[model samples]
Target chain A: MTSLYWAVADGWTITRRDLTHWVRQPTPIILGLLFPIMLVLMFGFLFGGAIAVPGGGDYREFLLPGMFVMTVAFGVEGTMIAVTTDAARGVTDRFRSMPMAQSAVVVGRNGADMLDSVLVLAAMIGCGLAVGWRWHGGPGATLAAVGLLLLLRFALLWVGIYLGLVVGGPETVAAVQILVWPIGFLSNVFVAPETMPAWLGTVAAWNPLSATVSATRELFGNPGWGGQSWIAQHATVMAVLWPLAIIAVFFPLSVRAFRRMSR
Target chain B: MSVVAEGLHKCYRDKSALDGFDLTVAEGRVCGLLGPNGAGKTTAVRILATLLRPDGGRAEVAGFDVTRHPAEVRRRIGLVGQHAAVDEVLSGRQNLVMFGRLYHLSSARARARADELLTQFGLADTGDKAVKQYSGGMRRRLDLAASMILAPKVLFLDEPTTGLDPRARNEVWAATRALVADGTTVLLTTQYLDEADQLADDISVIDNGQVVGNGTPDQLKTKIGGDRIDLVLHDADDLAAAAATVSRVTGADTDIDRDDRRLSAPVRNRVAALVEASRALDDAGIAVEDIVLRRPTLDEVFLTLTSAGTGHGPRETGRE
Candidate 1:
């Protein structure tokens, strides 16, 4: 009820409004959860026979971690579009004039999107387990991997908020989504970077999303590079470092752009 | 409480938005800024609101310098910008509560204020509806309510009544009257001369990035003097003779302008001049097309000062 309490409630109230908007449709979020499920069905049944898990386990096991990271990448686009819509509709301008802490608006909305991301992650993982995927590692390590994916999602949402703020004009934002899909697929989410060409392997390894996926694969005890490179041995390090680095770089940038928006 | 600015200068490349603009408003009073679009009225309001920093000069609101102590100034002032400032995705009641919460009010207090504002604006029935569903006037009223939640000592309303129907404008005017009655100092910029005339106790007329005039409505009206007479004649040749007759008899400057119209300079006696002018025009066989006598409106005063037609000196210099 105090001022700080208001600050907390302010963020969630804004977030809840978006939740209500999504609840009205329930299609996009449902589809995001379903698209990866469809991928799991096609790859597990159709292509599982030829795929190799490198003497680790079933193809579904390897694919689950990849799909989780892919969902994070795909979900960033939704956040980007939402931010763009808010900007285009003059909702962002309306927020600027109020006495509200400017950063809380974007932060609160992203926090709301994170709720959707968590639900989608849980449902996708549920469908994966319903098939033949197994987590050899203990539940503790499994929880840690889930932690990494959420951090990655949170980090990427801020980046999307910044991108949305940068491209203030909305018409071109959707066109820019085409560029995002390629970047999401090019990372080590679906295939090991070693299988890619040498130049692409380098790019795949350095991708921030790759850090989380590579880290998740190890934590799940499924399949990874297995200490062939520094990232394989230090996946946990990269998992934490990448999201922190993104937050460090993008958080203030978003807030500064927001403050200067009204100025 | 008071907003005082001196030597304020702001510019946009190749165009000056504010040219050494100066404004002074004492505490607990409603000050209206009347000007056409692009007159730098909004620019001055933004500077006072701390939403903008002047390229030069200084401004203070409630004893805090706008540029140096912008946060302090912001805490003391509220701004309802030209564009409505409510989140359209949120309901009208939610919008007010959100702003109230932003001002650090408790949830119960915020909700109370939201309900109060909704009822005050006649929006209680539609309080649960999203702002996008509300008419332009309703959204505008909500925008006003958002700025007023803090009961700020200084409120900046930038073009508050623009694009509203007459009834909606009256609603906003009523709100303004109520706010001023409650001892909230207001500084509003408007292109609607009538709104300013009705709501503002003190009027400041800005033109081309400068203050052309400032006063109470009655003072400004008196400064412009009595009603004017303009006539249209049937033909140019006949109009010129009519112009000669009227000018000689009334000793008023008369000219046969375009469209065979004659403009007779100020006449204190409208009835006497209308009868004499009509009689002379009739004798000259110049049929009178139309005749009208009316007080000089704010529009005319604005046109005169800003359009370079009057050739009068600085509007405030000789008057004060």
Candidate 2:
């Protein structure tokens, strides 16, 4: 616990450093939100009303949940890429040489990525609001929606962190980016998972991304799977379980990879 | 003792980085680790610093086994790595304070330490400048200062001046001297032979993942003998003739540096080898362009000894 204390503190310091770099550079920060915003502009208007939402009337209403999922996807890969860059730049090697904490590297990276995810969520919510997509469930529902979104982001964060450790260098980080597109598209973000063909729908519904969005629609009293879905009734557990499953499986693996790399 | 390693064997997969490497550095002595590239000099330093674990054997720093009590080891050790650990985004002052905070020092103590280091390193005026704006010399000073933030008993410096300009290198040498004066022991690795000469109380030459030679600089130099006879000839043909003539007169080994037309060889005694090479060169019609005998350097000693053994002899040990 004491070791973790110094490590986490160090990690937070590194986060502040990373943030300062972003603040000074400003390019990546602008680029971070541009893709999501561009998607909001492109898809929100073009596909509005043409695609059916999971729980309700407006296609933009359905699109809001999808955008939230996209935000997590868009943000988490950046964490992985930044880690690979650190490895290539010898920053990671430099840290290892210091008397600083080892676990702090991962913990700090995850913590910083979480901060970015929050900013991404805010931008996404603002965009959704601008596009006439409303969160009718008010304050409690908004908090619940964000809670669900954070849970999913936490899960994806571990996966990205692990992938970052697994990938040897920066060049391979792009290959990891390919997985995000498929995972994001397959979820209930844009359309109801049940509405898809039998096999993909089953996968889409079971996927943690879809689980969060499905549970999110239930909180907002948004349309989801014709009111008969199993996910709607057990929404709270699914939301918590997804992050737990991700943390359990990937967290240790990432830690193990981190340990292996220290050699 | 501030640092001790006994039979540490570290292997990276199929490659061994440290094999039965051993050393003990007393408090307040600057121990220099000298070796060429690919030698395990950095590896030994890392293990002693508790940054790496050996597959076999043990190491202790400040009376704590590095593997078992890493936090304790960390508490008593400061490391200035070969590269600067300062975050480029942070200003010079911020970088020092960040390290201070990381060491769990109080705000006041951290600030005081930062100020002292800034004054000592000559970085006081540039405190507000982002590290990226500082010159190479400034960065090296800050790196040394950052390592001293907590004033640990032992400091590890891996190649403290590999790329620094001569003036900047001297600045670092002065900083290290100050640390050693204050009773801080240091373990340093360097490819520059002069660096070891300038700072080390004891020298260890690591080659091919093992300790080839370890002793005081004079002790290591003695392995190549006290003196060497250098004879430079005008023509390439004279080199071969001179070698045969000198080998007959004195039984010392001979080598002619191909590019420089410099013929160098071991001698039983400087005076004896000089007399012999001269008489032989004159007798064999070898025009000796220049001839001089002087004390061999650690560089010559390292080349002649350490014996990578292309079928030379058994591994010699203990300053022989």
Clashes of each: 1, 5
- List where candidate 2 sits over 4 angstroms from the true fold: A1-25, A47-56, A82-107, A192-197, A223-236, A261-263, B162-171, B307-320
* Interface RMSD of structure candidate 1 (Å): 3.2
- The alpha-carbon deviation from the true structure for residue B48 of candidate 2, after best TM-score superposition, in angstroms, is 1.5
Query: What would the TM-scores of all predictions be?
Result: 0.83, 0.89
The DockQ of each candidate is 0.34, 0.40
Model 1 local distance difference test score: 0.77
Residues A1-263 of candidate 2 have per-residue lDDT tens digits of 47767777888877876777777667887788888888887777886647765445777776777778778877667888877766654467656655677666777777788888888889888887888888778889879889888888888888888887787676676676777788877877777767789788777777777777777776766556653557545766887898899889998998888777647
Q: List the residue pairs that clash in candidate 2.
A: A54-A223, A54-A224, A55-A223, A55-A224, A56-A223
Tens-place lDDT per residue, model 1, A1-263, is: 45566467668767876786675457777777788889888878888778666555667777788888888877777877788777665456556545565556875877788998988898988887899777778999999999999999999888888888877565656666677667766777666777778888778778888888878888888776543667656778998999999999998988887766544
Per-residue C-alpha lDDT of model 1 across residues B1-320, encoded as one tens digit per residue: 48998989887766889898888998998999988778889888877877666888999898989888765676778787766767776789988887787777888999999999999888999999978888878988898788888788898888887788888888788887888998888998888778887889899888888888878877776565555667877666676677677776556555346554555444567899888878877887778888877676766566555644453211321222
Angstrom error of the Cα, residue B308, model 2: value is 4.8
Place model 1 in a CAPRI quality band: acceptable
Docking class for model 2 is acceptable
